[model samples]
Target chain A: MALKFLVVDDSVTMRRIVMNSLKQIGHENFVEAADGRDALIKLNSDDSINFIITDWNMPDVSGLELVKQVRANPKTANLPVLMVTTRGMKEDIIEALNAKVNNYIVKPFTPQVLREKIEQIISTVNV
Target chain B: MELTNSMEKLFEKLGDLKSFFIYGQKLIPTLQKILNFMQDTVPLLESVNKSIAESTSKIPKATNQLHSVSNATELATTEILDLVDGISNELNSIFSKTSELKNRLQKQKELAEKLKSKYQNDNEIDEFLSYSLFDDELCFVDASSNKIQESIMNITIALQVQDITAQQLASVNHLINSIQEKLSGLLLDLNGKERESDKSSSQHESITFNENARYVKDNQSQKLADSLVAQTNGVKSQKEIDQLFSNKNE
Candidate 1:
């Protein structure tokens, strides 16, 4: 079954890049959100969305906060989240880890890196 | 004669006593007023001393807060710089990817041209002209290749993201400059140093920030040229753009 992925980012270009990468990986079903709040709406509305890829810096609701909300919610508690962001600092990484993101990938990531992170997250969750 | 001498001496002594009593009478009320004034001033002086002690106690805390503000602003500035760096790195990646896409499209277009030339038959052209339904597959391939070139052009236009990000970072850089100047003024004020208004008021003092602003300004013109070129379907390669930036830096 094809996974329904929610790709969240404020930049349209970044979203397209992520979605294109996902498409290249054979995951064509995507629900794109402009930010965390939008992601939540999509997540709530769409039951088939099984995975999330989000950027860290967003207005109103950040990716970290979105992950926290996902973890807190009973419906999406165990859903896998991969934080793809430019916030590569150690503290940011720790914060994302503490937020319970399944995996993290820094920005300017090659498609291969993204694929690895996605695979790693999906595998970890499956385990 | 002894009575006369004694009486004279007693009169002299009486005169001196009269002088002393008169002086005491004059000084007693003034002395009392002075003592009362001292009594009133003692508590006031004590209160003043207590207020001074309290203010002195808070000095360290105020200084610590100023230090914290400075540290916080510095941290914010560092984070913004990191964000800017990340954005630049991302733009570079996107440029490379777009360049690769352009090359692929060019290759496809070249192949399509080669196929078109090889398959072009004068008899078939007459037939294609006669029947609208007799569409040559090569013609479709040529059109699709042109579409690919258009898509590549669009990608090149999206490189305007760099310009937008640069402008945003420039604004952030301006804000950081303002914060640093304000912090500098605050510190100087706290330390009782002479706050040089000339230096603090000018927002162009930080060499690093100024250089960044200048880069953004230069990129603005580049961004304009890039947009116009992209519109004309004449996009520069990533290597050429990099060279242009490096030349500007030099």
Candidate 2:
């Protein structure tokens, strides 16, 4: 099976752009959710989702909260999650790091940067 | 002598009290003026409150309109993105067809040259042999093809602005709703009612927004993000470090 990505964001435009960007970089398998709560539902239903690309500042549950839940559950504890967000401050980055995202990419990222980070994470992980 | 002194002192105090009563009578008009001033401001205060209530009522409408704008732009952006994707696919197909055309032209030229050698004086073979249908056409298309693909990619990249603007509008919406909630609370208080608990008028008001979101045309923020990710990805994360210390204590 191909690597299925669970992309979580509140904005429909963001989800489309992210999925499109992923397709541009040769990763076509994608599952999208509009918010963190919806992301958890998708994660629960699809055990095939190997990687997670999430955005922070979502409604209901935040990206940080979602990552914490993913980590807390042993079933998805070790899955590699990357945060793509508009938060560029050092403290926000540190907070995300503490939440244990494999890597971080700021918003308005080029496909090249996404490819670079995805390749980096794929190298270190089983996926 | 003591008795006379006490009587004189008492008389002096009585005179002072009589003078005070005279001044007190004079102060009544001034006191009435202040009372009249208070009565005059009662209507002005109500007018100010009415204005605040009216403005506060408009906030929800403003936020709704903002949401409408965000949705409209996102719809337009999605349509543009779909068109770009379709054009990119068509461009790829054009490139492959041009490559095939180039190959077919090469073979035709070779065949015509071979026939010319057999029939050196044949006019048709000579005409076919010298015919270069696309001498510089393929080369020019190939060069411009890259530029076109690049332009298409740029269009896709710039579409990120819609998402960025949506986030910005969301941030603004959150701000507006929060103000609305506060103004509602203030209005409630100004109407001489007991202050109620913190109940937000809009459910979205409670959701936090990313205030720092913006459309940065440059990659400077990404560079900083890259450096931070680099710094953190190398080592055990802060959570891991915390876990390690906790485990050691155990």
Candidate 3:
């Protein structure tokens, strides 16, 4: 089955690399956004999107805020969000977990690590 | 009374002499002790003063050399500090330039990779075309052999027609030669008038054929050139159109 994914990042290069990596792992059904706000707009319009991969720091509406908004909404409350970011601080991890992110992946990671994390999230959420 | 006064003067003179001898004996010991103490202490005081003067005389010269050394040290320390500052500034400049060079190298790498991918794609397309156009041995052989056979067939047919026409023309030439030989004297007089009329008529026909062929060939060549130009232009324009479409899609 194909999974619909939403990838959001402020850097064009980062977004392309992530998208390419996902494609490499046989995940071709995805859309992109430049920031959390754009992600939100896309989410509001599209209900079939089930997975989100986002960078933590962005221009408007940070990833944490987006996660909070998703968890608050009834329609998207159960959507799985995985943060792929450079912020490896312990405080950032705890904050993301508290906001109910399904999983987290740090930046500069190999595609294999990303695939492993995605698999973990799908398995856990599917059950 | 005169005899008693002479006896008293003699006794007074004897007492005065005994007092003078006792005073002289005490003055001799006191003078000898003062002379002995002076001779013993004078050399010791002179030696002490000479030693103090020698030490005092060297102090100013030693102080002047110390002052010169201190000044040299201070100047050397200032120069060293300036050198250190210059090195630090140079290091900072080198670090900044290194950072900029790193960024430029990264950009160049990205562009090179993009160009490499494009070239690879173009090579792949060329390979595909080559494979499709010339892959089968039978097809390659047939194409060349078929052109050779067609040219041979055209030449053979043309030669056959020319041989038949030459044979018929040979018979007509023999009949005309026989007639010329049979009526040579009478025909020579009529040949002059016929030759003039034939020349005029043949010239008219040749002029008409030349004009017609020239007009037809020129028109055909012009049309052919126009079509070739249009075909090439279409091929060139198609690439530009494709580029525009791809850009729009991106």
How much of the real interface does each model capture, measured as fnat? 0.00, 0.66, 0.00
Residue-wise C-alpha lDDT for candidate 1, range B126-216, written one tens digit per residue: 4543443323543464565556544533443333233234334434545554655565555556556886754433332221111221212
Tens digits of lDDT, candidate 2, B154-197 = 78778878777777888898878778777777898888777655
For model 3 the local lDDT of residue B187 reads: 39
Instruction: Show the colliding residue pairs in model 2.
Output: none
For candidate 1, the TM-score of chain A alone relative to the native chain A: 0.96
- Using lDDT, give the best candidate's number: 2
Instruction: Please give, for residues A22-98, the per-residue lDDT of candidate 3 as tens digits.
Output: 76467888999988889999999997798999877665687889898988999888887888765454445555655
List the candidate 3 regions with Cα displacement exceeding 4 Å: B1-250
Question: Model 3 misses residue B203 by how many Å?
Answer: 93
Using all chains and alpha carbons, the TM-scores for the candidates as numbered come to 0.41, 0.85, 0.34
DockQ measured for candidate 3: 0.01
Q: Compute DockQ for each candidate against the true complex.
A: 0.02, 0.56, 0.01
Model 1 misplacement above 4 A: B1-250
Query: How closely does chain A match the true chain A in each prediction, as TM-score?
Result: 0.96, 0.98, 0.96
Model 1 TM: 0.41
Tell me which of candidates 1 and 2 scores higher on DockQ.
2
lDDT of 2 by residue, A3-27 (tens): 8999998877778888878987899
